[model samples]
Target: MSEDLPALMSYLDGLPEPHIVFDMDYRIVSANTAYLREFAQGQDVRGQTCYEVSHRFQAPCDQAGESCPRARALVSGQRERVLHLHHTPCGEAYVNIELAPLKDRRGRIRYFIEKMESLAHHHGAPGEQGMVGRAPAFRATLEMALRVAPSAASVLLLGESGTGKELMAKAIHEASPRASAPFVVVECASLSETLFESELFGHEKGAFTGATSARVGLAESANGGTLFLDEVGDIPMSMQVKLLRLLETGTFRRVGSSDLRHTDVRVIAATHRPLREMIAQQQFRVDLYHRLSTFPIRLPPLRERREDIPLLADTLLARVAPLRHLSIAPAGQHRLMSHPFSGNIRELRNVMERAALFCDGDVIELSHIEQALAADAWESGAPTALAVPMVSAPVPALPGHRQAQADAALWEAAQAHRGSRAELAASLGMSERSLYRKLKALKR
Candidate 1:
């Protein structure tokens, strides 16, 4: 090796950057220390192609040799940048790669130099974060979301806190025709009473104390797209009236501005509270309730779907796995299945990630999982076994009881294909009205 090779090795060893050199035949001639550590797991892996060496697999890249990035970079003799995807034993991550052509003194390109960088804010799997549910109930809810996603109808998602209602709303936006435009989300509970209207309807210059210049609100910002109103049930009555008017007229006036601006924003509201119950109590507007419930989607609680727990846990583990898949102990899986998920998918995810923190090697043992579950259980308060006293009450044949008994006997006789109610009433020598009343009374 030349002195330059020593300097290059010193400059590049274990730097954590993804770089590899592909020979003219698209085979990996040499790889930097970072590339070796990241791709090969520090094994003696040389004389393989870029894809085979980087992914530790010995096949034609993408099932087509020439279509590979390295091969293309070599052929074109031009630097190419592309977003590549790969799945490791641990989890899935996206890599942005720049492939450049390397030439010798004869001006002939000898090899292709590959530089790759991971662009994961919080890595793991793609399309998993924004939509995190695998339960049957979640599947049903997600199916409903997918069905409604293509339409522009107003969607009202109802669920408890931390159930990913906003995520569903975004899914609807992404799958809709307005996906090409902006998707705006607003937490309706954030604004104070004074700023509520201004926040939703925008404000002109000098509209109020801090209104120095003109400002567009969320509704305007989401024009020609979807506007997600999180915790929409929290909006004040005054704002509700304005929102209804905007929905009806498709026009809104900014604060302190006489001009009315028309917008094509589609509203997708979500709340954990029971709007119908709120309407009955006069807390929520009846008309607004009806308007928002154009397509209501209720997310079922996690406890209702115990069958889907294991699948969800496995999927979550796969999502958070490191370079190699975390070997979750069978006992840990058993414990996960045994517990009732009170917080739904969000809670399960937290448990898995926390458990992964204390895990050793590639295997996450029962002890670590237990520690995570126990800590979470303690945070939410330990579950206790309580015995309820079984009381033995004497049967009192009260008037109500006698009436119900008579009705049950008559219904049983009817079920047995006995005489008609009128015939039975005649047999008992009772009036038709009395028989009808008695029969009606027992149905309750």
Candidate 2:
């Protein structure tokens, strides 16, 4: 440490947010009181590498496939900011990292000062509830959310159906300055054209044939908070102009009333359909689309982040069967990873719940997974092959006679198999644990 390093640390301690000073090699030179209090829990982190202390990684963040703000700042000779999932005393949380390269009198970068601000509403790993996954695709969406949260910018969430758009909207609201206020949702798809205006803007008594009493609209109900418009693409075209007016003027009037009402609510909109195509076809208004998409974020589909299936399954299983403490076996997990979830996280949750119902034991097995998927297809009035596309061969039928025959064939194939167990398990449409168990039974 330099002689003036103590003076620098004294300056950092006077500041508010968590701050750390580290050398170009990523070794921590000193930490501010805020850093020790929030991140280190009062423990000193002077000698350890920043990556090791923050992420528990052996190498730097970029080496471990994450964006490194320090590296970017070093190149640009300016401050750089990034979102990262850091290990904290509470758990793994999404944090905003701001790194600024400090140059010496000779114009050479000597040290770096990093600041961290945790996103309280988000988690990097699966917990009992809330958001999960640490994949790159998921992180990108979260980073955008964090960047726009502090401000009152209108956000638009774009993704396929069942990709958890509503959840993402709520997360943004919770992370924003409006965390204490209401977070209301308007299901645009379900509202009829006649009811759309009345629901969005309150209706006075005797406004329509069925208007028995005065009711508050969602916009007024979400005053000083957030109003999430789910499936904004499905909103009736006839009512698009009204919505546009409300967003533009922040003023509305109840049905059958002349008085205009004002609200200070922030708006968040989500949709699965492409707004640009809708605009081209004249199905949606161009002005409204621009108003709602000030900061658009696209959520990733499940297939893009397959490694999160197990964590999501475990979390959903706990919610679906809380008392049973059920779990998915390795083979069951492989089966889940094999299918392309067109419905995304929503479909995955349904599969986990159905599999829980099929399995009577504590652990959900491969057979249970197959039966649940088949049942889902049958209920949807589609054949298994057509409904859920499998990446490899089709899953075997679960009838007793057919299962026995399938086992015999699997045993023969296992005997001739030469690849790794993981490859063999994937090829057989089963887990390695299941294969090992079956082989041991045959030997016995």
Give TM-scores for every candidate, taking all chains together and pairing residue i with residue i: 0.56, 0.84
Model 1 scores worst on lDDT over the 10 consecutive residues at: 384-393
lDDT of 2 by residue, 313-332 (tens): 88889888889999776766
- RMSD (Cα, Å) of candidate 2? 6.2
- The lDDT values for all models are 0.66, 0.84
List candidate 2 stretches off by more than 4 Å.
1-8, 14-16, 105-107, 385-444
Among residues 3 or more apart in sequence or in different chains, the pairs in candidate 1 whose N, CA or C atoms overlap within 3 Å are none
lDDT of 2: 0.84
What is the per-residue lDDT of model 1 for residues 74-135, given as tens digits with 9 covering 90 to 100? 56778876544444434545455678876767777766677876533212233335444334
**Residue 31, model 1, lDDT:** 77
Residue 268 of model 1, lDDT score: 92
